[model samples]
Target: MAEGDGVVKSAGRVLGLLQVFAEHRRPMRVSEIAQAMGIPQSSTSMLLKTLTAMGYVSFDAEAKAFRPTLRVALLGAWLNEEFATEGSVDEMMVEMARATADAVILAVENGVWSEYIHVVQSEQDLRYALRPGTKRPLPATNLGRVLLAAKPDDEIERIVRRINAEAAAGDRRFDVATTLDAVHAIRRDGYSFAHNLISSGASVIALPMPVPPGYKPMAIGIGGPTDRLERGQEMILAEMRRLLSQYLGG
Candidate 1:
């Protein structure tokens, strides 16, 4: 390979490796990382060695696992400060988790998908298990619906059509009219909620977060078992609104 091509490949692998760490949110063995990245173990080992030497990753002798070090986190710390107050989104998600005892997710639109960028796991015994980096169809998920609500109807229709076009045969297609109706309802009600839409016996309540111009739109959501979320919907919405108003000034 050309020297420039090699450099780009290595850089992509480095970022991909970090993404794996972010998604799992735990120490990972070399084999696990290789399997997750679909790369060779030797290549993964070399990357880990380089990162360890750079003080960006550390190896645990006892557990035989590797984890990103504080240095990796510090790399993006200033970006958080520049955008939203550092830890403000995290604090808001944590507070919502505490108030509802359910999973709280921060999501943004990525193409035609709603990607969960961060998640606070539920504390309740019976709850849905969600992780950061999970993606849901923009028209099919409550979080996605709130995000779609932020867009114009014409744009939403285009996205729904694109999603349908890309869907495999036998997969459910998003009905443009129904999706538009849902988006209208979300715009009117100022939030989105659904039961047993994505997962059986699960429900989610989501609201769009205000973003500065040029920033990607985001949605915050609380999810849990249908019965529990239904029972606490009012309280959860109140707490969500309160925290959003407090931390995000919306």
Candidate 2:
């Protein structure tokens, strides 16, 4: 869909507007977008019309709104197995959850964001309920911090600033120096853990997976109530390393 030499170049803008659609909870009206983002109503209408016709969005003629379609998830699914390594990370996640009785998540950096692509819930009825495709801010959780800390310093600062802009001013537990020190420690020690950063009773421990040559593998985290993970984080960390190594090779 490349434009001619001198025609126009709003395709990027159109795609960006569609991305905005993915993050929203409810279908948006042209006026709602115009007021919310300062974009013009006619432009929004045109973009919505194009998106609806392309099957990326569904138009509610009765409600007069445009909603995202299943196409996006289908597109993402087509690429998951391509990116994931062939291993027992899934099996290890389940075993870890059962043995530790803690919820476990398989996460990987997807471009600028980190996604929880798989989950194994703890057996207890009180355990946290997590699902596939859970996305969260990278700086707000230990899982994000572990991945962020592994990035280059300049990149890490840029991400930190972005997270700060979206975060409340008073919520000031993390800063560059302290976070960098934490990252250094994780890299040296080969695992990351945190308690009560995202939820009060929640604790998390993450370890990097050995990915294939020329491909970045991923990191998986075990999370549950601090009371349980605290009593067993060290043991879980040990077992995960041994099991992951068996599949990935030590």
Candidate 3:
């Protein structure tokens, strides 16, 4: 591999190792992490050592395992604090999560992708939930459409091309015409609703949020099982629209 490709691949491996630890939420032996993440034991050991030096991972000599340190949690603390300081979104997410009994998300555009910055999980046994920092292509998803609603048609199409190009890196392709049509509809309605777009058996309702200065465009979404979200679509959209209107002044 070329130098650049090697760097990127190494970075991905490091992230995947972190995910393994995060998912299990426990200290794990190097061999266990290597097996779970499909990484070579030698590479895993070196990466773990680097992370340990950075204070993002800790080693337990007696247990012969590794775990994420508190520094890992501290990484995003400042940004999360900013979100809470926004005043309404934190409190509003609580109410919305209760009202819909589904996952409530605060999402924003990051380059050609849409990312969930905060997620409030549903109380129900069956619900759709995504960890904060999860990212997806900026088309086809309700949250992505809502976040890009303010752009002109031409600009939206350009962004769609960029998003599709990015997805192409993973052998994924999106229909340009269909995606543009979705963007037009979202622009017309000032909101978006999609079924089985983000995930199988899941539906989402997303609307633009009133973002403060210096912040990127943002949206709020509610997601749940397809049937439940469909049945409560009217109520969910009404409540979210009302909340946005309060902050955005219609």
Q: TM-scores for all candidates? A: 0.83, 0.60, 0.66
Off by over 4 Å in 1: 1-43, 60-65
How far off is model 1, as Cα RMSD? 4.2
| lDDT by residue (tens digit), candidate 1, 1-250 | 1124346878778987987886677999999999988889999999999999999999999999999999998887765564454356766778889998999988998889999888888878898888666788899999999999988999999999999999999987999999999999998999998678988999899988867678788999899998988898899999998888777677
Error of 1 at 81 (Å): 2.0
TM-score of 2: 0.60
Worst 10 residues of 3 by lDDT: 80-89
Query: lDDT-based ranking, best first?
Result: 1, 3, 2
Weakest 10 consecutive residues of candidate 1 by summed lDDT = 1-10
Q: Against the true structure, candidate 2 has what lDDT?
A: 0.70
Pairs in clash, predicted candidate 1 = none
Off by over 4 Å in 2: 1-87, 166-174, 214-217
RMSD of each: 4.2, 9.0, 5.4
